[model samples]
Every structure is written in C-alpha cells, then in structure tokens.
Target chain A: MQPAVPLVARVVDLVKNYYLEEVVVRALRGITIDFAVGDFVALMGPSGSGKSTLLNLLGCLDRPSSGQYFLGDQDVSTMDDDELSDIRSRYIGFIFQSYNLLAQYTVVENIEVPLLYQGCRLDERTRERCLSLAEMVGLGDRLDHRPMQLSGGQQQRVAIARALVNDPHVILADEPTGNLDSRTSDEIMQLLTQLNRAGKTIIMVTHENDIAAWARRIVRMRDGHVESDVRNDRSTDRPAPAAHAAGLTASANSLWGGDPYRQPLGNDRP
Target chain B: MIPYLCLLLGFGLLWLVVPLAFSDKGRRSFVLALRSLWLHKLRSFLSVLGIIIGTGAVIILMGFGEGSMQDALEDIKRQGATNIMIRSVKASDESSTARQQRIAVYGLTWADYERMQTIPTVVRMVPMRILPLKVHHLERSVKGRVVATTADYAVVNKVQLAAGRFLSDEDDRYMANVAVLGAHVADRLFPFENALGKTVRLDKYFYLVVGVLADRMATSAVGGSSQTAEDFNDDVYIPMQTCRGRFGEKVVSRQSGSWNAEQVELSQVTLTITDMESVRPAGDVVKDLLERYHGTKADWAITIPLDRLEAAEREKERFVGLLFWIGFISLFVGGIGIMNIMLATVTERTREIGIRRALGAKRRDITMQFLIEAVVQTSLGGMVGLLVGMGVVFAGPWVSEHIFDMHRPAVLNVASIFYSVGVALLVGVAFGLYPAWRASRLDPIEALRHE
Candidate 1:
C-alpha cells in the first residue's frame, strides 16, 4: 500500500532451515516482507516464531535457504558468505541486544570499526566523523571511555553510534532496549524515533507491545510465518516520561549489577 | 653463502612486511595485535620466553664453539703448519737382556738427527735434548724438563720472552752453563727475586739464568696423534752443547738397590720445511729414513702438526654442523610454543573474530592478523636474544680471564645473527599457519555465540 515510498529491502517467500542435532528446523517458512526507506518497522514474535531468524536474514547476517532477498535492487539471498559480509558492511547496520562493543576499544575507536573494515584510513576526516557520531549518540565527553567503564545505557549509545558511522542503508536493531530499565528504554526509543524521522530506515525486533507501538508499522511472526501486519494510528502518542518513576528508581538502582529482567517494570499496568 | 642467505631472508621479510605496512586494513590489524599483546604483556612475554632462550643459545653456543676451535687451530698454527716433529718414544719390544742389565738404548740417536739434515725440503732443523731433571733454588725445588736446543726453538715455538735474552750460539759453542727459565720454574725458583742474572742448580750444575719466558697456553694433545702434551711454561731452556757437556748421553740413575742407565743422544728433531706443500713429503722422507735405519725397533714417533691442523679443521666443520642442528631443534621447539599460544589466542578471541567478520573482514585478513602477531612476537624475541647473545660473546673472554683465571675466546659467527632472526621468522610462519587458518575458517555466527 506504500507505493509512493522507495523500497530499501524486500524479501519474497524467503525460507531458512537450520539443522540442529539431526533435526531440520524450519526457522523461516516462506516469509514475504518489504521495508521502505525511512520506515520504522517493528518485527514482533514470541520465542521460536522465527522473528530472530528473519532479522538475521534481513541484516544479511545469513543467507536464505530459498527465495530471493533484494537489498536496494541487489539479490543478496544467493550471495556467498564473503559477499553477504560485504553487504552487511556496506548496506546493513546491526545493533545487538548486548551492545557488542569491542572491550579493548574506546567509544570513538568502537565507532570507527566499520570504517576500518571498509579500508578507510583513520585520517583527520575519518576521526572527525567518528567524533561526530559519538557526539550524536550524546556521548561527546565519554569518547575515550571503554565499554566496561561505561553504564549499560552509555554502552548501548556507543553501539548505536557504531551502527550509524558507516551511514548504512538500513539499521537492524534486535531488542535494542531489552536489558534496560523502562525509563532508559523510552529514552532509547526516543532516539530511534528521531533517527527514523531523519530519513533512516529502521527494523527493530521486540516482544513488548509498548516498544512495538513506537513503530509506524508492526509485523508479527508465529510458527515461522508472518501472522499479522498492522499500522499503529496513534504512533505519535508516546508514554509519559515520568509516569513510571517509582519503578524506574528500583530498576535503575540495580541496573549496574544483578539480572535486569528480574527488576520491576515501570509500565506493566494498562 | 652467508650473503646469499641474508639476501633471501631479506626478500622473505619484505614479502611478509610490505603488505602490512602499505595496506590500511593490514596496518589496523597490526595495531590491534599490538594492543592485544600489550594488554597481556606478561602472558605474551611468557609465551615468547622459549624463543628468547632458544635464539640466545644458538648464537652463544655457536660463538663459543667457533672460538674454541679457532683457539685450537691457532695453537696448531703456532706450531707451524709447515713443521714436522719427530720425537723419540721408547720402543716397548726391547731385548730382555738389555732390560735385565738396566741399560736401555732405544730412541733417535745423534746419527738420526744428522741424517735427517739430508732431506731436500728441510729449511731448518732444531735438534733438542730433553732431560728429566730436578732444579733447586734456595728452599725451592721443582722437577722440570730441561730443553737443550738452539736459539731457533724460541722463534719456532713462538716463545715470548719476559726478561733478558735467549741462549746465544756462543753459549752453545763454549758450553756455557747459562739457561732460560720457563715462567713456572722462574716463579717457583725465584719467588721473591728476579730470575734473570740468578743461578739455579740443575742436577748439581749451577746454571746462570739468561732469560725468563712469559706464560703461554700449553698445547694439548691434538687429533689423537702421538704428539705428547707439552707445557712450554714448565720447561728450562739451556744450550745444546752445554747440556751435552753437563749431562752426557749415558744417564745413570741409582734407584733403590738398583742402577739404571738410558742412552738417548737426541730427544727430538723438529724440521721446518720451505712451505706447507713440502711438509708432508719431508715427513715421509724422515719416516722412511728412520724406518730403514731403525729396522724392527721403530722407536721414533713422527708428528706433523700440519696433519693435526687439517684434521682439526675437518672436525670443526662437523662440530659447527652439529651446533647448527642443536640450534635448529631449539628454534623448532620454540616455534611449537608460539603455535600453542596462538591456538589458545584464536580460541580466546573467537568473539572478536566474529565481530571483525561481521564488520566485513575477509578470511585472509584474519589470517594476516594472527600471522603478524606471531611474527611480531618472534621477531622481538629474536632481536632481544641477538643482543643478549652478542653481549655474552663479547663479555665471555673477559669474564673467564678475570674471574676463572683461564683463557677462553669467543668468536661470534656473524652469520648466526641473521640465521637466528631468519629462523625465528620462519618458525613464526611455519608454526602460526595452522592457528591462523583455524581462526580464518571459524563461522562468524558460531563465533559470535561463543562466550
């Protein structure tokens, strides 16, 4: 229905099968999808729904067992491992749930990793770009800080800057705020919304309804297939910032240590 | 041979190094490896310890081996490669009647010395009469070999003079009782006073000391030849005529209830040929002449130092080869250590490999990174070992001379430096190949999932 928008990525009846201990798992069964430019799309599913597999395929982190995946008019489904890697480097940006920043590197250095793989010199222009990306993620003062030294929210911000440094065609975020307190999660969602408004395509995977509500379009997966596709009319109606302060204080206190999922949520109520 | 080897090594080093220095990705990988190594400084150092010890051992062992061989060769060289020595060894198969009568006459006689003078290649012949005698001075007495030879003996044997002059021909003609004191004898006989111008009694004959020889390293038995170990520092040199006049050919000693007399006119005849080419032929002539005259006695033992020198040279080649293999084996073991550490590093950094692969690093890039790390480690260890080995080589002689009171020369084979460093690089590449390949072949998704 969005014929006016240019398609950044399109998947046609894509299938991905995994062999685990002699059992062939149909992780993705003929899933068809299209992500348009500047679209904030959320892929939602329970565990074993193949939503993660679909995200992996869309990110070019894997090849489909069947069908074609077109990333900006190039069919990447049949590409080899090295070509897939190149596609990931040039066209796809991945934001992992664990904020997989290199432990040895500082903020600016981590953000410069993708460009380093692109064979770009760490010259004055490249350094300036990395510094600007760091500033964009609101970590201007922490440019020299390593991931271990930073709090969880700051580490995730570094990861976000790393994903944006290459100016990729699409940003694939898998559970962007899964480990954060609801307040920090909202803050991260706000950053994603701002990035989406600035003409960047974003595909995020989340199980929480509130996180999915932030996306303009929602694609739900079940049993290795897309169960439903819907558009949220009230996408602009964001949750109040201070509505969950009491629960936020409890989760924030233990965010540095202990299991994050066990912490109380700020907006469990309707 | 060494230059060609060095050239080949240079090309090989360039082959590995050019890409890393020129390519941005390669340079970044190098920096990353350096950072990773720096982070685990102690572990990296421990990992390379085997290489350090192995490389250092190669240089030091080869250096010492070369040095000692050179020293032995120098000793032979001092004896003159063109010289043939015929010493009188008592024949074991003397007649039973001669032994029962206590008169043994078996050795090179004065006639044999005179006959050897007929050899065409004989440039100079110094006949020596060696007498086992006891010398006494004041409260000191020492058993010493009294060498009665011409003044040519000093130059022929490279004897250094500490003080005074050697025995002149006039002293030999006049049969003067003037002698040259060996360093050991002089030190013992005249511990408090200068040996020159002093009198030391040898078997009841007081001989005036005309000279004192400086201490020199004694030549040991070489090439398992019949040449007996001679300590020149323990000898007392006297004139030939004076020795004959004082102690005649017939030396009668009164033992416990027995009288023994041994008749030996000349103890040794050292012949110097015109050049190295004539030494072997001259030696053959001497042997044949002695064999013809002595018949079944065969009392003379001919020792050509040139033969010993050649044998020693051949032995040195084999020794150096053996040392090379020892060094090779150690370096090989060191290489294995590097391989082991690299494999563990590949396993430990699986996640990093995944991250890099996700960022579009090619398999070759991963291989290059790990290979560079291995080479960097070995190269660093090799350089340090080289410096250490050279230090030991340079300092070894001085330490032995000062602390142990012994002379030990250490000649650094300059080629060993290049060999050690080159072999270190080879070891790195050889041993690092497997781990690097394994790392490059790792699946990115599987690696990312690793803890």
Candidate 2:
C-alpha cells in the first residue's frame, strides 16, 4: 500500500454568481481544478473569464456560490466566515497584485501580520522569524522602512515574504506583478519560481503570457470553465521535473492521467 | 458593608472583561488606532472640543453650586446649630396702642421663661431684654442696642469675650451694674481709652464695663421668611436683674420729633437643646405652651437652626442633580458629534478596513480598533477639560471681585472631576459602538474590491 500524499487544495465543479436586483450574472458556470502538494499552477485568462473568481475561491477570500471545495479534504466551501479566516490564516497565504502592505507599518511589521492573526505574539522568536523572512526576500536592511518609502519591487518583495510568513502549504498570488514594470515583474516571477522550486505549491492568476510561462503547468479559464490546460516543459528554468511528474520510470505513472496538465503525454497513456 | 463588597466585585468584573476585549489581535488594533489618530491631528482635536467645553462647564458649575450651598449652611451654623429662638411679634389688635400714651406692656413675660424652663428638651435658657439706649462716656455719646442676659448667654450664642469677663449669674442675682460692650459699641463708646473699667451712663444710671466682644463677621439677617432678623455687634450686654432694676420695662423713645413709649418684659428667649434630633418636636411643644399663654395667633414665632440646615441640604442636593443632568446633556450632545465624525471616518477608511481584513483581522479586531480610537479622543479631551475647569474655578472669585464687584465663592470638588472624566469615558464607548460595529460588518471581498 502506498502512503497517501495530501493534496494542497482540490475543487469539484465550483460555481459562483453575482446578483443585480433583477439580473443574475454567472461569474463562474462550472470549474474543476486541483493543486497537488507541490504543484505550481498558473490560472490564465482574459478579462471577464472568471479567473479572478476562481482565485478568490481558492484564496478563501470568498465562498463558492455552489460546489464541493476541499482544502485538504476539509470541505471549506461549507465553512463560515470565522472558519474561513482561520483556514486562510493557517493553511494558505495570499499575495495581491497591488502589494497591499499596511502603509503605516514597517516592512518587518507588515510581514508579521499573518503571524499575528494566527495568535503569535511579537516576542523575540516572532521578531527573529520576521527578520529572516525579510532577509529571504532581499529586504534585510529595509526592515524598518515603511511601504511608501520603498520602491515597487521592494513592496512586492515584502508582500511575498508576508505570504510565506506562516509557512502555509499553498500560496495564492493574484496578479502579483500587475502594478509593476516589466523588469520588476520578471524579478517577482523569478522569486515565485524560486519558492516553487523549494517545494511550495503556488497557484497564481494572471493574464500575462510570460508570467504564466514560469509555471510548470497552466490552466486557462474562459466563461467560468477551464478552456484548456497545458504543461510547458521548455519555456523557463525549474528544477528538472520530479520522477512522479515525468512518468519515465514507474508503471504507476497513470496517476498523472487525471491531471489537467496531462495532454502533452497522452501518447503514453495506453 | 455589603453594598461596598458588591461594588468592589462589580469593579473586578469590569477589570477582567475590559482586557479580554484586547486579545492577541487587540494590541495591533490599538497600535493602528493610535497611528490613525496621529495621522489626523486637527480633526481629532476639533472633534473633542465639544466634549471639553461640555465636561468643563459641568464640573465648574457644579463646584460653585455646591460651594454656595455650603456657604449658606455655615452662615446659619454660626448662629448655633442646636439653639432655638423664640421672639415676640407685636399683636395686631392694638387700637389700644397705649391708649392714653401710658407704656404698653405686651410680649414674652417671665411666665414664658418659666414655662420654657419646664420643657424637658431645653438644656439651657438665656433670657434678654433689649433696649435702644444712648450711652455717654467721657466726651462721646453713642446710641446702641443693649441686651441684658445671664452668664449662659455667651455659651448659647457662640460669642467670645475679647477682654475681661461676661456678666456672671451672681451678677444677675445681686443686680450688679457691670456690662459687656460689643465690638462696634466699644469702638464707638471708648475710642480714646479702654472701656474695661469705664463708667457709661444710660439715662441717669451708670454701669461699669466688664468685657468687650471679639470682632466677628456680621451675621446678615436670615431671609428664610420664618426667621427673625438680628444684628448683634452694636449691642452692650448687661445683667438681666440690673436691666429690670435700672432701665425698667417701660422705655420712652423720642426719635425725629416723635415721642411715644413702649414696654416689653422679655424681648427674646433662646433655648439650647442637648440632642439635635429633638429640636423640631421640642419647638412644637414650646409653640403650644407659648400660644396657650398668649391667647393669640402669630403673637410669637420660633426659629430652629437644625430644620433650616436640613432644608438647605435638600435644596443643595436637588440643585447639584439638576446641574449634573445639564452636564450630561452637553456630554451627550458631544457624544453625538463623536458618532458623526466616527461614521465619516469609517466611510473614509473603507479601503484600509479592507486591507486589514485581507491581512486576516477578524470583525472583533476591527471593532476594537475603531472603538479604541474614539476612546483615545474623548479621554484626552476629558483630562484636558478637567484641568481647564479647575483653572476656571481658581479664577472665579478673583474675576467676580474685579468685574462684578460681587463675591462668588467656588470650591474645587475632586469628586466632580472624577465624575466628569468617568462620564467622558462612558460616553466615548457608548457613542463609538455603532460606528465600530458598522466597520466590522463590511464584507472582506467587497471591501478589498472597494476602489
């Protein structure tokens, strides 16, 4: 018997809608996606394609209007606000496109926010952890600097560190570089790739092609459903694929069959 | 004692619950509250200005109100808290006003004095015969009211002999013609020499001066409608028996070309009571006894110091309560102003609220943050206002003396300061509730989407 590896997050036929008094706008018709424990998946689509809605549901920022959503089999779609807050604080980290660091707080303080919500006092240990996270994001000397004092790249770096502060299993990034220049955008993408290479599961929402190209697999949404899913093995640098993902050695490689990113290897399915 | 324990227990409960509201998330909110308040200094001060004026006005007004009430009681108190006065009022039935111009005798007699002595609550009796007489010493003649009573008069009236001795009871028994001059009377009668052994003539009789009274603040005639008026400084005190023997009861008066004569046996009788509680009842008994003897209505009136003291206290309590509500209304209005500004603040910081929510702050944390900010504003206002109110109280009497030329006494009541500050805190929390609650209920997703 093989030991089970818990999935980071899984969703089955998720649907969401917005009501306008007399009109019901279907934001998400039906969507099914799963993120493995160490998968790096980018959700890509055009505007009005419900990619943001999917990211929101995945981030635990909102409940699915209808669907079975499991955060490691906990079925978070049925959870209430407080439970969602706990899950968001404990199980997942979020990075916004706008780099929403609290302006009044210093860089280190901003990074400590999620830890605080997790009921961690800002004692000596917490301070040390915050310093290391800031250093990890290459802001070791800017710990005491406010968000307004730093440049766009520095602020996003602070957000990245904030998202990873609690050691959450999965990170949800919503257009992490939407407000940055192309050069700064490439730097943020490199940081995300480095994190994913270290075995962190990263789920990102983006409309940019090059940004999506950094991910090992891409899921594209259109009109609230997955229009296509593809695996890009040649676009960027990542640690060579894992044995379980490459399917070159084991007869048990059929585990990749149900993967939305399995299209490129369908010739080996029989 | 039981009530005190209950109060202590209630305080302990408050101490416990207030801190629990500030859990792990609460400290961050507090820091946020402080930062946000500092971000807008002018608006915070302006918002709290109303509370300052309202609270300061209430505290200062209440202090003066209480001081004046105490002032009135002390005025009555100096007359003697345990003493009751019975005075003779001229009857209205006198077309027989000395019909024939013979001296008319009507009022408290020796029999009234004798009946007062028989009452059980009467601790001591001081009888007096007052006559307006002109006294001549050396080269000056001053007209003054002279009172004739015994040694116990000094004890009953709270008077101190400045020099020499008051008239002893022995002097009353043997009809010695020794006298005590009052402060004003002494200043007039013997301005050149000490009046201690001088002989002052009243008509054809001469009395040796034995004592002079200390200069004391003049007790203005009480205006309570039920009390009679008296001025004691311009009087000379003599032995009662000597007054009857020499001046007699009939006094002839010739003022401004009017010559008429009136006769009074005992002008007034003051009785001291041993127990304060028995005054009103003892007064009732004295009234019944006097009315039975006089056979007339309103012929005599009684004045009980204890009764007036209680009435003054009751009036002061009611006045303080009225002032309290006036203060509360202004603070209440100030609280409304706080709510209005806080609501605006909530709307303005909607994006900040969203960002905090996205950072994983709970509804409880958001509520505490805004509530603490409101608390900070009002409490700062409250403390500064307390100091300002005290400053006003300190300047009160001086301002009165320089501007209105009327004396206004004010006291700094510590209780009032505490009450004002406590009310400010209470009103801050109460008024901050709805805004905080509203801020907390904003949807996280929608809030983040807020432009």
Candidate 3:
C-alpha cells in the first residue's frame, strides 16, 4: 500500500554547535526527524533543550553545521544565504512568539509583503487574494489597521494571514500563544487547530502541556535529543468537529484542493 | 533660449529614466521607503534642511559671481578693447594754490599730443580738455563737465547724434562757438523746446547747440582708469580751438571764499590702435614718450583696457574655483548630517530588517530600501533648493536696487541646478551606503531578538 501521506520535510543527523565566549556548546547534536504532509506537530521542551535551534534549522533560518535537511526532496542544509532565503520564502511560514508584524504597515500591507519579495505587483488578482486571505483569518474589517492599533490576538491573526500569503509548505510557530491569557491562548489554539484540520501542516514549539494537547502528534526534547514521541488520539482539549467549518470549508477547498492528505483514503469531511 | 531648452530636456530625461530604471520590486521598495520616511515627517524634514541650504548657497554664490564678472567685463568692453587712455594727473608735490604763483602748472602738454599723432600704430587719437563748470539756459542752471575736443571725438568715443549734427573740422579751424549737448544736459537746459540752434552759456561764452547726443548707459570707473565714474549724459562737447580761444588754460573755482586755479593743457588723450594685437605695444610707446618729456615727475598715467580685460578673465576662473570649493564643503557637511540620521534609523529598525529577511528579502533588498530612503530625502531637498535658488537669482538684483539703492546684478546659471541635483544624489548614495550596508549585514537571528 502507498504510504498514507508523503514526507514533506526530513532532517537526518542534524548537528549544530555554537561558541559563547570561547566555549563550545552543542545546541543540536545529531538529531533525526521526519514531518509528513498535512501533519500537525507540537514540539515541546524546556529552556536550553535546543528546541529553538532545531526550529531555526527546520524553518531554513539557519543551516546545520553537518547534516542533511530535505524540504520536499531539495537538499537545503548546504544552501547559501540567498538560496536559503529563497527556500524560506517559498516553503516555510514563520509565526513568532511576539507576533512580528511590521509596525508601520497596515494589516493588508503586512500580508502582501511576501508577494513583494517574489517580485509581484499589487495588481487586482494579488490584491483580491490578499483580501481573501485577510478575510479568511477573520481580519476582514481591520484591513487598514496597523499592528499597534490591533489587540494581541488580532495581530497574531494578521501574522497567520501573512504566513499563509505565500502558501508555504510548513508553518513554524514559536510559542504561538506564549504571551496571551489562557482564554486568548485557547482561542489562538482553536484557530491553529482549524487550519491544520483543513489540510495545512503546522509545527509549533511550546513548553505548556495543555498547548501541546491540541496537536495530533507530540515530540518532546531534552538535552538536544528527542526524549519521547507520541500520538495524541484522545486530546480532550480539541475543538468540536463542526466549529469554524462553514467559513473555512470554502477557502480550504478552493485554495488547497480539498485536503490532499485525506482524499487518497476516500475520507470525507465530518 | 538654448539654456531653457536644455533645462527642459534635462527634466524630460529625468522623468522618463527614473520610472524605466526601476523594476517592480524596486518600485515596491521605493514606496516602502517613502512610507517609512513619512512616518517621521519632522525628522525627515530637519535632516534634509542642510542639503537645501547647501544647494541654494551653491547656486546663489555662482550666480552672483557670474553677474559681477559680466558687469566688470561690460565696463571694460565699452572702453574699447583696442584703445589705450592717457590721463594727466597733478604731481603730488605741486599744490594748486602755490606759495608764489597761485597756479599749479602741471599735466599733459599739447606737444605730447603732437608727438603721439606721429606714431604709425595710432589709428585715431582724440584729445580733450575737461573743465567742471555750470551751464545756464534761460534762468535754469545745471553743473556739468565741458569737454573741449576735436571733430574725431564723436566717432572715437562712440557718441552718436540724436538731432542735427556734431562739430565739424571747419567748426574747429574757424573757431566756431558751436556745441553738442549730452542727452541729460539737453533735457535739463531746454525742457520745453529743442536745444538745437538755441544758445547756452558756459562762464563768459555763449555757444549755439548744434546737436544733441543720444542717451547711452553710463560707464562706472574700473581698474587702471584714474577718473571717477562718468555718466556721459551730463557732458557737453565743443570744438578744441573754440575752447582754447575762449576758456584759455587757467581753470579757477571759488571754494569757501578761496580762489583755486589750475592750468592743464590737455586733460586726457585716448589713442585707438590699428588692431587688438598692437594695443599693448603702442601703450608702452606712449608711456615711454610721456616719461621722456616729463622726466621723473610721473604726472601722467596710461590705461590699456585689453590688459584689464585679460586680468579680469583670469580672476574669474579663480573666483569660480573658490566658489565651487565652498559649495563642496557645505554639501559634504550636509551629507554627514544625512549619514548621521540614517545610521540612527538603521539601528532603530534592526528588528524590522530581521522580519524582512525572514520574509525572503535579500541583503540587496535591505540596502536598496535604506539607500532609496536617503536618496528620496536629499532629492526632495535638492528640488526645493533649486526652485528657491532660481527664484532668488532672478529677483535678487531688483530687490537690492530698490531697498539699498545699489545695482547688484545676479545672472542665472542654468547648469548650476543640474549640477547641484546630481551632487545631492551622489551625496545621498555616498553617505547612506555605510548605514545601508550595516543594516544589510545584520545577523537575522540576533536582530529578531532585539527590542
């Protein structure tokens, strides 16, 4: 039988070393990992567990000292800075802990930034797509609002819309709800859960167990190595099956072709 | 007309080239830069003020230089480039009211005039005896200079006739009491009727006005010329023989109830050369002849307008060079101001740089954004300065003339606008590069962590 989902990203024996004031510190020591298409992963670790370093390598922000990293069959570990930037723009989406939206740009302008780097003009087609993306993220009314004017959750929504603007292969979130209250964090998590269920791949880093419970798979790291990897079939914190379905279904099918991960198994949306 | 056309062409080329040179990405970056600059409107305006002052100073200084240089050249040109002038000056040791004679017998003699006429290179010579006197015509009087000259005076001095005729050689040979009134003199003495055929009195003599000279622009005193500024409009001309017979050599004036008497045979002799090339040598010969006759007293001076013109031409080059360096130093300091502000901006926007990098902006992209921002500021400043400078250049002379009662001309140099703008752009690029390069080389990981 063909594998249920093809691998989207693979890292083999990835090693990273950092020098702090003349002392060598091993941030990531020969770690191996694979992420399948449309997979939702929660990478959990305490401080100094090398989680941020691994995330940087996975997002193509940094290259490993000695290892192989493949994103959709392209060897990206040995790529130069410019080539890495190109790869990141095309295949990786980043969600920072602090919601790094350019303070000067309007919400719509922030979303249009990735397309700007791709040499796209602000023509009608791109403008319409940017509008639709903003609307899909529930920021339809705040298109011209700057980051400072919006609340924390709205700003994150703008960041998410920006991340999805280029239709990247995998979305990397670093402590996506680290700065929010529990209620706001739950709301942000539900938004992520809906995006993942709609055939998007997401890898989030967090130290909170409850935040990790929202993901279908959890990978825990300690001392620069994966300590445990588990599938969460009974994560009670998951949202209702039908919540946010109506608004997302139309954009999901039209934008991403009706869930490539579940279509091969002949499974229909619940 | 050609300068205006060239200015129009320069603007046309700039309008066409700027849009075509930028790609879509570059346009986007340019727009982003403009938005960022707009965010701090006051800071941007202040940062650009130095450039405005610098560029305006350059154009204003060059304009004044060109204007004054043209003024001096025009004065020299009217003196006739091929003409040399010899003027009689009183010897310093001889007093006008001498202890024994009460008459200062000095200056150029009639024999010197006879000697000069024999020179082969002397194409034409006009000798004149100028006496400061008052003229009266029917109850109205005006103080003026009476010029006793030969018939060649009108042609040699470029004095054209406005009415009737100038003095003829017969007028001098027969000692006719006929005179030519200068434009202003005619207007003042007659006022209600034509001065031609009318009689005007100079001291004890009455002369018939044969002609009136046309109005001409006055010539100011320039280098190497001993006379004060002359307005030819205030002079009256008469035949040399008539003046010698009627006025004699003694000129007496009463000042504060004291009698001042001076005897000068010839006040001035202007010699025109055959061509420009022979003017200097002929001047030397005239000086040598005068020296031989006068011995060591040194009572006469020679002025060659051609020599003064050449010296002025050389001085212009040095003046322009000095002006350019002053402009360059101001622009350099203005560029430093731009650099200082841009460096602060780059440091403040470090996290923004990281965000852009993560979103796939190349190093060149960051550099281009900051560089474009700096260039936009200076270009705006340059344009404002250009308009203001041109305005001041065109209106400066008129303002000074009215307010200060001084005629200071300012000629517009069209090329200065283009030069200032190009230099402003160059300054933007030069000073903005370090900050831009610093921004581009920022480590993305660390930048994201910055506050």
Q: DockQ score for model 3, please?
A: 0.46
- Model 2 chain A poorest ten-residue lDDT run: A261-270
After superposition, which runs of candidate 2 have C-alpha atoms over 4 Å from their true positions? A1-5, A239-270, B1-17, B20-22, B91-106, B118-122, B137-140, B221-225, B249-263, B275-281, B284-296, B398-406
Specify the poorest-scoring 10-residue window by lDDT in model 1 chain A.
A261-270
- Per-residue lDDT over A63-91 for candidate 2, one digit per residue giving the tens place of the 0 to 100 score: 88899787775788988877777677766
lDDT of 2 at A199: 68
**lDDT tens string, model 3, B1-451?**
3356446656754763485255666676677778877888899878888888888988887788789888898888787888888888987877643647788788899999999998899988899999999998979988989999988888777888899998899999999999899999999999989898999999878999999999988876765455466688999999999999999998888879999788899999999999999998898889889999999877788877888887777787787678667767888888999999999999999999999989888788888888888888887888878878888988998899999899899998767777777667777878989999999999888888889
Q: What TM-score should be assigned to candidate 1?
A: 0.79
Best by TM-score: 2
Model 3 Cα displacement at B159 (Å)? Answer: 4.1
lDDT of each: 0.84, 0.80, 0.84
**Of 2 and 3, which scores higher on lDDT?**
3
True contacts kept of each: 0.53, 0.46, 0.58
2 or 3, greater by TM-score:
2
In model 3 chain B, where is the ten-residue run with the lowest total lDDT? B1-10
